[model samples]
Target: MEKVREFIVIPQKKPETVRDLLGWHRKLLFDCLKQELKKRLIESSITELNRLIGKMVPSFEGEVLDSAAKLKLQSINELLQEAREELLVTKKVIKSFYKSNETIIAAIVKSHMGEETLTRLRDQHEDTHPNLLHEPGWMLEYQVAKEQWDKGKAAFLTFGTFMDPAKADVIVISNPLDEKIEFNLDWREIEESRE
Candidate 1:
């Protein structure tokens, strides 16, 4: 099991103005608080989803238990479809939660830190990182960001429920570990291609 580590940042002295806080520090606090709220909401949805999975799994046992056990694609599809819908709604709610709370959090940060610090922080770009799981292709994305970062270009975040691959200026898709060969054509015009 993975341990959930939480951090609390306490200022040594009372903050007289927002300027006392470095821009990254303010972002860290904001991200921490926002992440916690997201965790609670996402956990609730996952708990129910897990329960549904438990109840539904036995229903599939029939296909393996008996020689005559049948495969019911409709039942399986319906189960997955429901799960997808639940997750999609959860994703939407989480994104909306961030959108709504960010402003209030920013205001609080500005009050404690100051308007100038907030302004600079908003204008600054930060690196994007992967979560603990380090989901596939994250490092690739980080690398791409780093390339842009090295050239003194800004890297910003875009929050959404789905990827707009078509509109993305950069895309990094890793091939599977297994060997593969494909004779195909990519119609899109790409720049700075890499292997």
Candidate 2:
């Protein structure tokens, strides 16, 4: 009864209820897992593309293109097929990622403005993103953001100038499609730099 006489105990504010803390932790875990998966997928895709590219015909300044060039055609065809398959898989991965991104954006929109506002935000995003239309891979990088469509359409939209314009070949906005994704002969300049 010594301290019970007139002692007033102030209850400490429960530090972020257990549920809130757990929710935050879970979100962090999800983000980490998603990023790791995405990294692995992108790496795999790049490896596949590189492998295909390695098997293709070497570039030259003025190589004679014989209509009857059958020596490397078979190997090139096989490599092309493999590349196509890998691109298809990559397209699926990209679509999944896009859906995830959209979901996250939608969540943010709903949190701040509600569902009705989300549609407007999405429209605004599409409008503002203004892709450079129908440019080849090489020029697309310098002038626009390009995305690979499932139907083998590579679409581009102008975003802005590159930080170091000379170093910027193209900023690939999306993964390649499943079909034989080929850049125009004019766009070969960008590809030559890698060689």
Candidate 3:
């Protein structure tokens, strides 16, 4: 008989707002969810491979070198190659999940943070990354904005629910409204792109 280790999880600060809830959930469970999903995927794949190899082993017990045996070996090799490919794909899926989730979460938080909160956040970021202020034109702008806009356009495009269509209508503007600048949105282009 084996004894399993018992664990107890203690809850921390309670969340007051949706932003707090999202932040807490990400901090507490996002990494765990990613790791658990990866673990389960890999475990199932290994179990399937082992079961396949086990079933195929009996056929090779007393078999002499023949075309059939060679075919079986080739098939096994193909399965192994597929498993390798699947692992690579698994990595890609996990990476995509990490990137997309971070962006979506940031978008939601950004919406909630508004101008003042973002200004404070930006101040903190600037304090930490003073080098960003010195970089050349586009690079400087990109470096400063990258944190706020992680796949910003793509994330915003898919943001919000059908039930709340208004939330999804994100408009990007460079200059302030007071600035003498003409801004136009082609509704036809937007509709075509959505399709």
Candidate 4:
């Protein structure tokens, strides 16, 4: 088994009301967080092994499997079913959070730049191009992602001076939210808090 590197995000600064926040700052921070988190999550999986065992209980081979093999397959299937159920719930929660974030970013944009500017930004975001790296309408994506990272919500990366997770995150606790929250990295971990 290969040991994968893990990174956690701990916020250095958090804006309460988005008073002076800008979309580009969000973009920069969110992009860095995203890359770090993604790099951490690519652990080994069983897809190849399951596919290789043809004619076995878990494979497409039309042969009869032994009792032990059948039991192993059954166990794996049960685990997969449980994972799927959890995934559905997590997806729902994430989607809802992102939707709320869109509204929050829109509010911030309108507050700073007015409704007309917000409308134009939305239009630009909707007009996605294949090669476009950053959005002409930067308000939508970055704000939510950055806000989440800023708020110290990403499981894998910790805020503060960048420290590698191999030594356990040495986070300088700043955000009150960070002090109140923790991540177990078990993937089944979900956080809920009152606003």
Candidate 5:
């Protein structure tokens, strides 16, 4: 059994204002919710995989439990394949959740900073802004923004939900605000192309 871990990040000093308190509370709550969802999804995948593997074991040599065991072994492989596909699908769904939240955050920040300010910030950061590019969710936004800029489309900064290191999803820049975008990267393709 895997031990599930929960993380909480509270402000160094207690929140002084009502808005600060609310913002902190919301961040903590959403962090927990996101972790729980990820845990559940992972556990579900493991359980299904284990169940299928167990069913497969009975079909091996020795005193095979009849043709039923063989059928079950075949079924196990199919089930495992299905589980893999489902896991990929689930990952995409999770990514989409973060992307949608990013959109909302982008809108809020844009409203406050104004489009020109956002563009200036992006330009300042595009090549050399160390902090923005290295931050947790910012890289994704930066990549999306760069892609959109290359295509002459509007770019946006948004927040992304992530688990490792567990910090509030912060600003990320995305491009092509009107089009549905996916950040599926194929490392193998990139490597092959380079060669």
Candidate 6:
């Protein structure tokens, strides 16, 4: 994996509604995914091209290229084209999945963390500017809310920083309402399970 990169957004003020909070969460995750996806696609293409060149270099040792060499080159080009097409298809699939489930995900988040609590938390952090995620007061509030409501299987939004991107610690919004719904955004696990 490439050096883990971060894409963060700090709201100048607190979110007015649960919808707004969820929107921020979704935006952050999607932005990060796009960044990571671009990096991975490039890395994959480079790796494939390097492998092709490694094979071609040995075959070109004798100077005179034959029909077999030409066919091999054609096959290598086809493999590269296939890899590019697969990456594009993967991108489309991810976007489609995100769009299809966006509304349902928002509804689920709203239900897990009620509007009243969201409003209360927003009011509590009304004065904290820009650094809501890092503010001591907001952090304390988040922990308290998690302990209080999470015990009852409720949910709340939280922030994390300097975490491993590959380990799925990207966004740790605790949603304990439904046991079957794994809200943990582990991209690897999702892909593995899908496979």
lDDT of each: 0.40, 0.38, 0.42, 0.37, 0.47, 0.46
lDDT of 2 at 68: 52
Residues 113-173 of candidate 5 have per-residue lDDT tens digits of: 5767545554544333122223455556556656754665443333332211133233333
By the TM-score metric, which is better: model 2 or model 5?
5
The whole-model C-alpha lDDT of candidate 6 against the native structure comes to: 0.46
lDDT, candidate 6, 1-195, per-residue tens: 123222224333334444444445545445535644664775588587769868797968978778888888777777777666666655444444333233233344345666564455445544332222334554464566457544553333332211111111222345433334423244455456456
Over all chains combined, what TM-score does candidate 6 have?
0.35
Cα lDDT, model 6, residue 110 = 44
Which ten residues in a row are the worst by lDDT in model 6? 161-170
Question: Sort by TM-score, best first: what order?
Answer: 4, 5, 6, 3, 2, 1
**TM-score: the better of candidates 2 and 6:** 6
Local accuracy of candidate 1 as per-residue lDDT tens digits, 1-195: 223232223334323332332222334335544554565565666566567666756887745544333244445456556655655654454444334323433444354457785565555532232231134443455466457546544332222101111123232222222323221113132221321
Per-residue lDDT over 64-91 for candidate 3, one digit per residue giving the tens place of the 0 to 100 score: 7588767876787687677666666555
Q: How close is every model to the real structure, measured as TM-score?
A: 0.31, 0.33, 0.33, 0.40, 0.39, 0.35
Error of 5 at 97 (Å): 1.8
lDDT over C-alpha atoms for residue 104 of model 6: 32
Residues 135-179, candidate 4: write the lDDT tens digits: 332334334445665665432222211111122121122333323
> What is candidate 2's local distance difference test score?
0.38
Compute the lDDT for candidate 4.
Answer: 0.37
lDDT of 5 at 116: 74
| Model 4 / residue 193 / CA error / Å | 14
Q: Tell me the spans in candidate 5 whose CA falls farther than 4 Å from its real position.
A: 1-39, 47-65, 115-195
Stretches of candidate 3 above 4 Å error?
1-46, 58-63, 111-195
Please name the candidate that would achieve the greatest TM-score relative to the true structure. Answer: 4
